[model samples]
Structure formats: C-alpha cells, structure tokens
Target: MRWRDTDKSSNIEDRRDQQMASAGVPSALLMRLLPFLLRTKIGRIVLLLGGAYLAFQYFTGGYSLEPSNTSGFSQSQSASNGQLQDENAQFVAAILGTTETVWNQLLKGRYVDPKLVLYRNMTSTGCGMGQAQSGPFYCPADSKVYIDLSFLEELKKLGAPGDFAFAYVIAHEVGHHVQNLLGTNAKVRQAQQATDKVGANQLSVGLELQADCYAGVWGHYVDKQLNLLEAGDVDEGIAAASAVGDDRLQKMAGRAVQPEAFTHGSSAQRIKWFKVGFASGDIASCNTFTAK
Candidate 1:
C-alpha cells in the first residue's frame, strides 16, 4: 500500500472532467420492469433470458459494432475537469504501474500488457458503452480497463477503506485483463452462452472468484518483490472483498442470498482464493474451477 515517492504511469487517460451521459437504451426503456429483476424469483429468470436473447441478437447484427484493436491502446481524458480528477488519475496510474510491473515480470517473455482508462460519467469502449455505475470492469472486446473514481466514496460507505482497497479494485479489474490474455474469459463467455440461467451464474461466480485470486497474486508480487505492504494493507483488501461479496450486496439490496443468483462468489470464498494467490503467487494456485 506504500505507493508514493515514484512516478505515475503514462498509460492512464484521465477524463474526469467530461460532461457525458449514457448512450444505451436509456433507463426509460426498462424503468418500470427493472425492479422485478431484483425482486421476484421469476423476474431474475426473465432477466437472464432477455440478456441472453439480446446477446444473441447483437451477435446476429442487432446492433452495428465497430471492430477495433487495442494493441497500442492509449488513454484519453479531458483536462477541463476538477482537482479530484488529477488526484485519482495519479493514484490509479501508480497502481497500474505496479500491476504492469508484476504482470510483466510474471509473464516474462509472453504476456501482453493492457491499458487502463479513467473517465467521468460515461465513455465509449471497444466492448460497448461503459458507465460509472457499473464500477470498474475490463472489456475484453477492447482489452482496456475502465474505472470511475466515484466508486471510492461508495466503497468507504460499504466498510472498505484505504489505499489498498482501491488498489484491490483496480487489481480485480486488471485480473479480468489477465483472464482475457489467458483465454479464461473467452471460455466463460462460451459457457455463459450455452448454459441456462442458474448454471451460467455458477460459471460467472467461478470467473469472478478467479479474478479475485489473480488480484491476490498481484498483491503477492507487490508485497514480496516491491515490499509494498504497510501493515494493514491486506486487511483493507479483505474488507473490500467482504464489502462487495454477493451476500453483502444481496443484504444491502434487501434480498436473500440466493445461490443461483450469485455471479460473484461469497465473502469467504473470495477472501480464501485471494489468500491462496497471495501466498503462492502462482497462477496454477488459482484453480477456482476445480475448488469446492
């Protein structure tokens, strides 16, 4: 968690100043029926089916998409915003530099590095239109990671605080990029397409947990090689993992922790897998696919 006294990464694009909005089928399109997805049992089933159908439709040209490669991915941000933009940009850049260092070393001669994009409100990505509300996520379509710093405020409210928590957030998203490079994400996507709602959610949970494990592995690199731990940094990471667990989110949303509804793994599972990765620093240790 001791990330200071160094230079910032050039790969980050800070757009924290933009006055942007969503370009998707606006909330108005599903406002009335949206609550049902989080409410009724049948609603969740319908929601998953609708998502699958739409994905199929889009795969068949329901929406025109531009095929763009991110081999030389670059960051773009508006400088016309606020001080928070600069502050968060530096914070994110430093963490990304740390990840790049670890992954570059771990992958040795093989892995391809990914770019991280920092934006406010909303932005267009190779995967699709990304918004701040979804938290931080990696778009495999573009091989770029997107983040909204506002999520930090929400994190503190969820009982997860400190620099390591934010670092873990970035690491988890970057873990998706790692998955992309390793082809785990593509396999998951294929399974998601072929499976039913309940089974698919199980696969999604495995994928998310594996990302958590990868994030933990990143921490191992920083802690062992970079000497970055400052006492309670690991605790901060665990707190964040707990805060964002499916059970905790379900409770916060006033719903039951339905096993079939879980896409991300439970609090204990996330923490356990992350610890495994941190302890081993070996990708082979992250076989959440085979773990019970």
Candidate 2:
C-alpha cells in the first residue's frame, strides 16, 4: 500500500483528454427499426438475432463504433478528481514498475512489459471501444491495460477501499497480460470455443481465478522483496477479490446464485486462489483448472 515513494513505470499512456467519435448504427435507428420489425413474428425473431449478434461483436473486440480523438490533454475537470487522478496515476505506475521487476526476475528477463492506458469516459482500443462501465481490463490484442480512474471510487462503493485494493485491481489486469505472454489466454480461447455454454463459463472461471492468484503472486513479491505492504494490505486485496466475484455481484443485484452462469468464480473461490498464490509465491501453484 505504501507505493508513493516507489519506482514509476514509463509505459503509462495518458489518454484522459481524448474524445470519442461516433460511428456505426445509431441507437435512434435501432429504436425505429425495432418497432417495425416487431410487427411480424419472423421480423421480430430476426431483430432479436441481429441484436444478439451486435452484442457479441461488441463484447469480442470486433465491433468498435466509437474511436477517440487524440487532439489534446487537459486538467479542466474537478479539482478534487484531478488530484485523485494524479495520485492514482502515480500509484498505478509504481505498481506496474514493481510487476516488471518481479516478472523479469521470475521469467529470467523474458517478461514483456505491457503498456497501461489511462483514459476518461471512452476511448478506442485494440479490443474495440473502451468504456468506463467495462471497468478495468487488459486487452490481449493490444498488450495493454485500460482503466478509468473513476473506477477507484466505484471500488470503494463496493466496500473494498484502500490502496492495496486498488493495487489488486491493477495487478489482476496485469495478470491477464501475464497470461497473454505465457500463451495461457490463447489456450483458454481455444478451449472455450470447443465447449458448451456451461463448460465455457467454467473455463472463464478458471481463467479469472488464475488471474486472482497471479495478483497474489505479485503481492507476495511486493511484500517479500519490496516491503511495501502494510499490516492490513493483504486483507484489502482479499476483500477486493471477494467483492468482484460473479456470484457476489449477482447476489448483490438480487439475483439467484447460479453456478453455471458464473464467469469469474464465487467469492470463496477467488479468496482461495489468491491465498494459494500468496502462501506459495509459485506460479505452478496457480493451476486452478486442475484443482478440485
């Protein structure tokens, strides 16, 4: 948690001032088309299918309708938000720097450092359009991490407040980048395509749990070598892992806890995986797929 005085990464890209350019089918056109299509059974079915296709495209990084303009950078936002942005930016850079150091040593200098893109509202990414609602994510296609600083406030709203919680979020995204580097993501994608919906969801849960473990692995290095973690920092990270579990989020929204619908595993699974990596500090211990 004590990250302010640490080394800052140079791979940070600040796109906080960009503006999104509108493209693709407009929402108004869809609204108009929907009513007309709903007049007939066939038309209504076709419309539903088309909507589902669009949603799939949007989620899979294939249909970016908005591209951000790279015009300029400014600090014209709220003074308090501006201060938080500056601090969070520095804090994130420090975390990235630490990850670079740890992975370089762990991989024996073969680790490729990923760029972190800090944007506001929306932006164009290799994995389609980035939105604040999507939260923090790493784009394997771009080899970069995307985050909106406002998500820090949202994390606090989810009851996971503290610098270590924020660090865990960033580390989890970086974990995805690690998977990308190791070809684990490619393997998972291949496996997902060969499975049914339930099986695919289970595979996704394995991937997410592995990322939580990777975050804990980073925490292990940060605590063991960097000595930056305070007394309650591990608890903060565990709280964050619990907060974002698919089951926890579903229960929070007043929905049933359906195991087959979970993509990110349950709260207990997340905390368990994190603890696995934290206790062992070994990448081999993070094989969530083979765990019973």
Candidate 3:
C-alpha cells in the first residue's frame, strides 16, 4: 500500500477520454422486436427494406451502422482525465510498475510486461468491447490488461476497501498476464474445449484460483523484498479475494450457491490458494490444477 512514492509505469494506455458512442438501437430492444418482425409478411418486408437501406448506406458511405461519436472526446471527460492522473492513475501506474519489477525478476528475463489500459465506461479491446460492468480483465489476445477506475468504487461496495485491496485486483489481472506468457491459458482453453460444461467450469475455477495464488506470490515479494505492506494490508487483500469469489457474488445477487457453475471458485478456495502462495512464495506450490 506504500506505493505513492514508487515509480509510475510507462506501459499505461489512458483511454478514459475516448468514450464509446451510442448505438442507434440497443441490442436488447432489437432482440425483443426480432420475433415479432419475423412473424408477419409486412414486418418481414419492413425488415428487408431496413436491411437494404443500411447496406446501401454502407456501400455509398452515406451513414454508419456502427456506434458513432459526433464529437470525439467530450470536454468534461477530457478534464476529468487530469483529475484522475493526480491520484488514481498514478496509483495504477505505480502498482503496475511494481508488478513489472517483481514478475520480470521472478521470470528471470522471460517475462514480457503486459500493457495496462485505463478506460472509462467501455472501450475496444483485442478481445472485443470491454465494459466496466464486467470489471477488470486481461485480454490474452492483445497481451494487455483493461481496467475502469470505477471498479475500485465497486470493490469498496463489495466490502473490500483500501489501497492494498485495489493493488490485489491489479496484481490478479497481471497474474492472468503471467498465465498467458507461460502458455497456461492456451492449455486451459484446449482442455476446456475437450470437456463438458461442468468440467469446463472446473477448469476455469482452477485457472482463476491460480491467478489468485500468483497475486499472492507478487504480494510476497512486495512485502518481503520491498517492505510495502503495512498493518492490515494482508487482510485487505484477503477480503478482496473473498469479495469477488463466485459463491459469495452469487449469494450477494440472491442466487443459490452452485459450485458446479462457479468459474472463480468459492471464497474459502480463493483465500486458501492465496495463502498457499503467500506462505510458500513459490510458483510450483501455487498450482491449483492438481490440488485437491
């Protein structure tokens, strides 16, 4: 949590000002109208006409069906970017820098630091449109991590607050980057393809748990080598890991706890794995795939 004085990372891509344009028709509305439109001849004719008009516009460069922004970057958002840089953005860069330092040393020249993107609302990513509602994520396709600062507020609402908690979230995404670097993600995807739904979910759980462990490993170095952890910092990290557990999230959403549907494991599983890595500070000991 003592990251204010740390160096900011140069790998940050700030896209907070580049807001996503609105789509003409919300996808949900289009889905709702689709069945009715397909059921009648007149409606079918209307659909055909609409499609033809859109295609013609596309070919003629008359209009675009894609989301469009009249003004590129809104003035308010551009101004807000300055405010973010003063604290939030700097904190992110510092945390990322620490991760880069730790992982680069841990991997011994094999680690390729992934770019971290700062965005607001939504943004285009290598994996597709990244949305804040989905929280932070690492896109292996692009070898980058995307985060919306708003998610920090969401984390606080989930009962995990403080700088170290946010650091843990960042570290977890970086852990995913490490998985991608080591080809663990690809192997997991291949295995998932060969399995049933429940089996696939189990694989996903293992993958997520491993990331949590990796985060703990990063914490280990940050605490032991850098001496950044303060009193109650570890608790903040644990609370964060627990807050986002699939089971806890499901319960919070008023849904029944279903381990079979869990992709990120339960609260206990996450805390246990994180502790496992922290206790050993060894990647070999962090493997969740073969663990009972």
Clashing pairs in 3: none
**Residue 44 lDDT in candidate 2:** 86
Model 3: per-residue Cα lDDT over 1-292, one tens digit each: 7887776777777676564323355544655797999999998998898778755764577633232354333322322323445588888988998999899999997999888888777676778668888999999999989999999999999999999999999999999999999999999999999999999999999999999999999999999998889999999999999999999999999999999999999999999988888887888887899999
Per-residue C-alpha lDDT of model 1 across residues 23-49, encoded as one tens digit per residue: 344434555678867698888888888
Provide the lowest-lDDT 10-residue window in model 3.
72-81
List ranges where model 2 is wrong by over 4 Å.
22-85
**Candidate 3 ranges beyond 4 A from true positions:** 22-84
- Candidate achieving the largest lDDT: 3
lDDT of each: 0.80, 0.84, 0.85
- The better candidate by lDDT, 2 or 3, is 3
